[model samples]
Target: MPCDQDKLAIDDSRWQVAVAREAVIRPLINAGQLSPIDVATACRILGLRRSRLYALIEQYRSAPVTSSLAAARPGPKKGARRLAVEVEAAIEEAIRDKYLTRQKASVSTLHDHIRHLCRERGLDIPSWKAVRARVEQIDRFKLVRQREGNKAARDRLRPVPEEYRADHALQIVQIDHTRVDLFVVDTIYRLPIQRPWLTLAIDVASRIVVGFYLSLEAPSSASVALAIHHAVMPKAEWLLARGIELDWPVSGLPDIIHVDNAREFRARALARGAAEYGISLLHRPVATPHYGGHIERLIGTMMGAVHMLPGTTFSSISERGDYDPERHAVMTIEELERWLTLEIVGRYHNEVHSSLQMPPNAAWREALDRRRAPFRHPHDDQQFFYDFLPFEERSIRRDGVHIFGLRYWDDVLSPWAGRLDRQLRVKYDPRDLSCVFVEGPDGAHWPIRYADLRRPRITLGEHRLAQAALRQRGVRLTDEQLIFDTVEAQRELLETSASITKSARRQVARRARSLNAADQGAAAEVVAPGTKDEPETLPVLAVEEWS
Candidate 1:
């Protein structure tokens, strides 16, 4: 007879029996060498015939859950009801409005409510057993969420397995941030600064690295945006710009981006951008580290490879007893980035993954072959990149929009000027504050530059530093000119002291990164279509040989 697994309910005795059978059968199945003696012992322990025990083992092998092993009783279907349609409707309404509430009403209270409704409507009351069966049909997760709270439901009902699984590439991608275990020097001064943070995304199915972004700044919404942008866009031009000959073909929008409950991951910009591109953001339950095991393990593997470099901290202080990472740090941040790219594309992708039992590149290609369809790419690369930028809402005055004490104005702002009914959204890139993209009323982003075109471009970090310096001098009310002047003065100070002070050197490195981004943008404009250029090679850094 066909059984409805969804409606089936096993009593405590059957559930306990299933659990006992699972304890004996699971290990034998995992061993893969079941002997007659083993089967006989299991049958004796479970008090079942040989044929029955074999059937149960096959059932358990198909689905290792305890519920799969529960015996189905041959009787009226557990939730099959012969009641009138109106009576069923009343019971459902009562359960929803009265039983599933914060008041934590009991079954008897719910029965009374249903009795009153039935009496009012001139319908027969449902039996207590029928009402209880219907209540049991309610999803446990939803029931817990309604009676208890979200946190309690999440903690109690989350999947118990440690590994998160995906069937194909780009189905589930996990993103995370970690501080690199090696120190990198400033580009100009060649002095050690703090370790850069790396934001990485990995495809869970193939265990391939989709994209990564490294920055001297701590993890933030901007870093997450940039990392995701890199993951979605094609990497041919990016790789060419870095002079890498290796192929990194992993690029596309993931169906679900699994992340932890960090503030940056919960940012409005990320959530909205993901929704715009038809991507779902899945946040693991709070404090569940194993839920993100794939990304965490990838980070560990990358860090292990980093320890082979010249200035590695070796994961812990005890491991670095007599070594000095800062003094030995010879590679600049740019060099470190290039080295990491090489490691990811040239080495990591080609090596056999322990979990997949094949090279990640091989797994990716095989998955694509089976699907027989090309991966989805962004329709407009530039528009896709701009969509993830951090934004703010501001009203446009006759002069223009004001952001971070700087006035941005363009001819496009003339139509929406001095409008009090609504404020336009302005999106800015953290790497360059020279211009901001304003979303007009017509649902288009218009680029607006500084009102004073002669003013130089400054990074968001530099702008903040300038504001801090002005505050130190007790300048409460400052204009754009004052802010720019302070920024220029700070740049001069950093240049002069960069070689001696670590903080100054770090600031210089950050500024270099900002300028590098701008330079890349300019270079992309001059390059002809379908043409490649030889990028200038950076100086090679020393590395100790791995045994």
Candidate 2:
């Protein structure tokens, strides 16, 4: 009808000022002290519309008006959009849909789910604060607890544990595995076999590597078994065996062994065996890496050391160039292991740690001053060894303990042998099949040798490979042919592995590296800048502030 009200009225501030000005002028106009033209002149001076002033003059005659006027920080009625009752509902739905499932439903992830729902429904989106507020309405502790269980809930929802008292070394140890970025050679041929995988354990408080194991073989439960054994058992004998003359001093059952959820780390043997010695196993929340940063850094540092070696595959392809990691590779697997050992005790442990400002060994020594608790050790080393080995339960037979079609016998088993009721647990190392240990009723480990004493020693892995190869070739392996096939299979494997190119070997190493339990990629933040088509720097802050 009339000029649109919004256009006819001045902005809210001027409108208020105009009303106030009219309020004071109206008395003069009513008193005949001033006329409409005089008020119009004042309205123009105040940048208030003359028409709005006239309109307000009429309202003032009828009702009261005030000077207080400014646009309320604009948004929705009653303030910023109350997270559309639907948006709040969406947030709860997203939390249930994402957090309640297996995927790590981090706060950001929950927010993303809500945003996606808002987009799909064509609803007005809210600020991140609004989304976060909705999320806060849910019981965070209960959410984490329900999804990940007790330990995880505490870690996620609560502050870092002050009770840990890191003044003592080995209070908590974090363990993980990495693939060395170097090609390793065979003992005889001196050809690159593969980039070896390394299992490492660090004393969390000390930032020192307490134990490590390196092998050409990929990580397995066996690898974890070896790493734990190395971590707990004294290193003096091992060092002496390797001819490494240095003090390792960092071995004992740790108070807590923090690890990630890998098959190796989650192995039943590891859990039970550790508990038997008062050590508890802890797995970090999935997709959280900073929890195990110390060991992850150690793995990175160790790999950096390997990268300096002659046959290094390097971290990425761009780092490799035309240089051949294989042809230039000179260290045998044993030699590499020795180098790693020497580097650990001789260099890393003794060198000053960047964070601690003291050598790890020195830190270990100082922590000992505050260590009031007696050092815990496994009561039986042999039993400890048996505990970690994979096992099968079977009653002793007329011959002996038969596993995977191989009969293993020992004089100790003779007492229980031929007794169908006597169910003995047989534990064997996957790396060595020469013998198996039969657990007695009293938990004694009886060494059961292969019945054919003339047969040479072979590992379970080799045996499996041989059996598989034999089957593939339409051949059957009798007990007499078992050793021969095993040896042949092993030789074939080594030769075949040795012939792989550096790039292929690097790929294998990379795959293993990606499998690291530390979630190596979790901490990285990815940002993509605009290209030539877009401005390099958008002066968002300055422009917004100026406006």
Q: Write the per-residue lDDT of candidate 1 for residues 1-547, one digit (tens) a residue.
A: 1112211145545656766776677667766888999999999999999999989888765544444577886787443447899999999999999988989889989999999999999999888888887888787878998999888898898756556788788988999999999999887767798899999999988899999999998888888988898888778988998898888998887878999989899887676556444466888876888899999999999999999998899999999999999999988888888999999999999999998899999999876665533455555455556567778888899999999999998776787889646676788888888778786654455677788777787889999999998999999999999999999998999899988899998998898887577557521222222344434333445668999
Q: lDDT tens digits, residues 363-396, model 2? A: 8888877676656565555455566766787878
What stretches of model 2 exceed 4 Å from their correct place?
A: 1-165, 474-547
Give, for candidate 1, the lowest lDDT window spanning 10 residues.
1-10
Model 1 misplaced stretches (Cα beyond 4 Å): 1-163, 372-374, 521-547
Q: lDDT of candidate 1? A: 0.80
What TM-score would candidate 2 get against the native? 0.61
CA displacement after TM-score superposition, residue 238 of candidate 2 (Å) = 1.7
C-alpha TM-score for every candidate: 0.68, 0.61
